[model samples]
Target: MADLDGDFESAESGASETYPQQCSALRKNGHVMLKGHACKIVEMSTSKTGKHGHAKVHLTGIDIFSGSKHEDICPSTHNMDVPNVCRKEYQLNNIDDGYMSLMDENGEQREDLKVPANDLGREITKKFDNGETFNVTVLKAVGNEAVIGIKCQTS
Candidate 1:
């Protein structure tokens, strides 16, 4: 019998682990990187295999921030990269020509950020004009960040 207990060892203390995933494992509403763009998968379909080929998977996704649609086809067994996504809350501080400033929970300010094009974005625009400090949800993935939604703070 082989020593199976020691076969699985933990990685380096602070090193993050990332692995490729098969196309068939993807699901709708999942975040993935397509053509170097961070997108959220909106639809997915798989086709039966032909005479001598493998099954093909069709994926349609939209840019999380830009709302642009992108589609691609790949073998069901094909490997795809999945991006790490995070969401955080922040407060609107100011708005510039094409960017808005935000302050985090720790009072740290980030300026000159383009507002996303979505309901939350529209709400932010409307609230900013009235000098309101609303809570904003930011989605971070694949080294990019964008505003996803706004939260109304209640006293």
Candidate 2:
């Protein structure tokens, strides 16, 4: 509905979570999207051009957050989606019932986030139980965020 004041709200909401890049340009130890999951490239190989036409790029990557492996094959000239990954540090305020209360450098706090179910998550839980202070490193990409690393805070 149009208002008399002609006011409208725009929501971008990270519309471009990923960008397209030629498969030939992708490199080892880089980031890419395979099978609709954001992953970190671990191995890549290109097959020589054959009767099939353009050379085929074979990619093998591990999911950034899930740790599951994904494989993909595409023409070298084809484009692949690359996730825009970022990391931030947050202070560990508290953990209640397997949920984390985290505060960022700007002092903004977020609660009720479930602890990641992985090795890093276990380490964070163990450290917090001992009354230690540290900052957690959060990795964000494609609308997904996870606690990936930790830095001990010195008082």
Superposing all C-alpha atoms, what RMSD in Å does each candidate have to the true structure?
A: 7.3, 3.0
In order, candidate lDDTs are 0.82, 0.93
Q: Which has the greatest TM-score?
A: 2
Q: How far in Å is the alpha carbon of 5 misplaced in model 2?
A: 12
Number of the top-ranking candidate, with lDDT as the measure: 2
- Compared with the true structure, model 1 gives a TM-score of 0.74
For each predicted model, how many residue pairs clash, with residues at least 3 apart or on different chains?
0, 0
| Model 2 ranges off by over 4 Å | 1-10
